[model samples]
Target: MSLFEGLSAFPITPADPSGRVDTVALARVLNRLADARVDSIGLLGSTGAYAFLTREERRRAVEAAMATVGGRIPVIVGVGALRTDDAQALARDARAAGANGLLLAPVSYTPLRDEEVYAHFAAVAESGELPLAIYNNPGTTRFTFSRELIGRLSEVANIAAVKMPLPADGDFAGELDAIRSVTSPSFRIGYSGDWDCAASLLAGGDAWYSVAAGLLPVETLALARAAQSGDVAQTQRLNAAFEPLWSLFREFGSFRVVYVIAELLGLCKVEPLRPVLPLPDTARDRVAAALIVLRKHFA
Candidate 1:
């Protein structure tokens, strides 16, 4: 199976306001996912606030992840930057730090053409010397990838998988078929939106690049396994337990809500980086209530 297969838990890079990473707190969070035995750990992902951290801080985050859970689980570090050279450098840094795989997003201040994006990925894949997943995050990057572009990138050496956004038409099967027809069969396809990933799995998607799994790996893994097994009823039940949290994620963004989740669960106490404010008191109350629902179901 591809290293990207199954539930890849994405954890926050617990850092203080100065953007300095707290390796101890980070290791504690990673230990939870490692102990839960999640399929992989996606460090420095969007949920990890990769875009907000400098390359130095990003390298520190990857080093901490590998030290904590590197041998226990595959670690896919995000190496996205506004410039291709910078992304390539980040990829190299991740490889040197012992990351097992790489995730790259086309983060451009100006809009990037498809060819530019493809070349950027090719350069990183060549330099990184590790399996890389295309981070197809149009929501943040503002660049939607055409199916043809994905097809071309799949053939690139070391570009092994693609972390897709939820299909807008809500047709996982149709979307999967469209992308698969163009790409090689071994090129893994995965989805990121936490609420819709079970359906994506049930529809034969290769993986779930999950945010919630970062903190709730045990519960999230149960849901992913149920969907992978084609147990529709059990999948629905497990997903229901996460519905409240999903709603909160959609409302406040998982990036913001997860910091609160870590604190609420007593894993860590931290805030989102500046320009991305912490959730309000009312929203924190909602997040707490959402956790209650999940606890009741999983307990």
Candidate 2:
């Protein structure tokens, strides 16, 4: 499989409230995903709290993940920064730490023009010198990539894939077709929204860049497999099992919910970085209830 294809589990970078990465806990999380045989590990992605972490800490997380995964699975480190140069430095750090690939989001303090975003991506891709997936997560980055820009970036060296949000119009096939029409045959396209990812896979998406898979790899992989095989009935059944969790993910955001999951699973005991509060008691109770529903199917 391509580095970007299949189920790419994006795990939380377990850390203390002060933002110091707990390499041991982080490795435990990666080991769980690796044991589940997720196709790839998306280290330092949004769920990993890459933005809140310092560059040194991000490097530590990548080194820890690469060590734990240890060539068994591809590790794609997220290298996003407000400044292009900082992002390039991060890409180089990831390469030095033996990351198999890179994921870059167009993060900015000021809104960026298309040309500027292109330049930022090109510079980071060149610096990383590894397969790079464009993270088109406008919800967090607040910058969307137009189809024309995606086509243009597909031509950039090392820019081999993209991680897109769920299409707004709910037409995964049409959106996939439109993007495939613009990019080369080898340039892969994937989606990150957990709720509708099975449909994306059924509609021919190359990957599921999944936050849910980070914590529920076994269950998520089953759904991915069902969808990828065009087993509509099976996919719907599995997706239904995940409905409660997906509802929690949408309500509280996967970033917060996954931390709660890690604690519930005994994988780690930590909170998200400050300013991103842990789910309040009421929402956390909902997450617990959601997990109970999932366990009925996967346990």
Candidate 3:
């Protein structure tokens, strides 16, 4: 529960042009977030380009993150894969790497059914003793898990929590209410669409699985803490300060903007994998301007 109780950062795995995981850059990013004291760090999540990494590269990325975080914070390694066997293999590797927990989405090429989704997680659950968090991202996976399905999955012993994307049209509170009414009491839930994070926290969601925190961990932490502590004024102020950046995320994909933002801030030099382009130059310029203003505002 502690892993999903606060700000959990999902950072991109920095890679060189060779598509190899850049251990040095990866270390710097992980160490920075660890120093900032995020509740947890997720290795090989969507933001980390999990699907793009080879099995070997994914293993090394988990190792690099664990090495840098060094038990300073819990590491939740993403073990999602298109096939159940690959997912189990990654889960085995994560357990070997001493990862604290696992995150999984029902990755699919063709669509998957409710029972098949349950089986996918059940298969991986048998692979290791590490706890599991279901990542329900329908947009990318093209497979959605309804509340009923989530409830059924929560019945599995190690399936501890779920990371749901923010509900659209400002219905975060309503969505939380509806989901909680159906799910088990022991199952924790949180938001992942970073734009609605403050609202999610204020609405009593369990965590913020943040992409922005990849580069600005401390700043994002401040926002989560303010909302979590019921500091309405502070939360509102920080949310407004981030509004422009959030707007950019809502326009250009957050996946794209994060790549540009990291390069813009000199945190790392990395690019999105093929089929996912980096931000266009014009969008990058606007993001650059927003980052400058945000830095000064945060300063």
Candidate 4:
């Protein structure tokens, strides 16, 4: 399968007020996304609060999402950790739990050479036994995979795709050309931090890993379909309808804004995770207002 061919929302792992996994809330979110016809559900991703979750919590989240989804769509589990062994263990657990694929990021707390990153991915690919998508979120890992490293990892067995978060000011075409140059013909390139879905699509992005889609899946899926069909007018219209929501990412963090919007849309019950802090009360009100406007426009 292609790396990220369809709509995938990174659902926040529901936590109770006491900070425990809230499976009931998680099930509700998954069912909502499935009802909206999202192609896949990504658990334990950056938005899912993976770093705060223990290994058991991660496993439980995967199981809960899989059970809730029940083969309706694929589940791509995020298996990122500060240690390679921990990440590998999570990958194995996710596979055993029946996840469709794995999203593996480089280990944090370590400055890895390009060769070391390749070797780490090589080991995880061997152990996971599932198709792997190399996650290149430099903001979190403090390391970005060079094109050379991507080329090496792409050659590894089971390494099927890449998730690249391009620098904001970087030359996207140049970066795309460099990645395309080294990756195999079958390797899919996913734009991880794409807020402007239409612009990214027009700029040659194959697919996007979207957080806004988590709140507005119907609109998000419509935009994705329009992009795939090369309907520029429709794509532009959809993007314009949701442009306010997309613009929030610039003023505030994406995950924080997404969580607030989720609660506003009644998709999730909890607030944003700690350390990240909840959106200001005024911001929450603005997001709610924007979402209401979007619902009407998209309707």
Candidate 2, poorest ten consecutive residues by summed lDDT: 62-71
Would you list the rank order by lDDT, best first? 1, 2, 3, 4
Give the per-residue lDDT digits (tens) of candidate 4, residues 1-299. Answer: 36366667777788865457888888887887889988777778888888888898889888888888868878888998887788889999999999989998886675888877777888888889998888898888888888888888989998888878855675666777789899888887777664555555666766677776665778888887787677889888877877777777768878888778767767666876566788889988878877877888877
For candidate 2, the per-residue lDDT at 140 reads 89
lDDT of 2 at 101: 94
Q: Each model's TM-score, in the order given?
A: 0.99, 0.99, 0.96, 0.94
lDDT of 1 by residue, 180-222 (tens): 9999889999999999999999999999999999999999999
Residue pairs whose backbone atoms clash in candidate 1: none
Give the C-alpha miss distance for residue 266 in model 1, angstroms: 0.8
TM-score of predicted model 4? Answer: 0.94
Clashes of each: 0, 0, 0, 0
* Model 4 ranges off by over 4 Å: 1-3, 167-173
Q: What is the lDDT of residue 73 in candidate 3?
A: 90
Candidate no. 2 TM-score: 0.99
lDDT of 3 by residue, 83-180 (tens): 99999999999999889999998989889989899999988988967889999998889888899988888888788889998786778788888888
Better of 2 and 3 by TM-score: 2
Q: After superposition, how far is residue 220 of candidate 2 from its true place, in Å?
A: 0.7
What does candidate 2's lDDT look like per residue over 1-299, in tens digits? 89989999999998888889999998888888989999999999999899999998998898888888978989999999999999999999999999999999999989999999999999999999999999999998889999999999999999999999999998999999999999999999999989999999999999999999998899999999999999999999999999999988888789989989999999998998989889898988888898999998887
Better of 1 and 4 by lDDT: 1
Could you tell which candidate, 3 or 4, scores higher by lDDT?
A: 3
RMSD of each: 0.7, 0.7, 1.3, 1.8
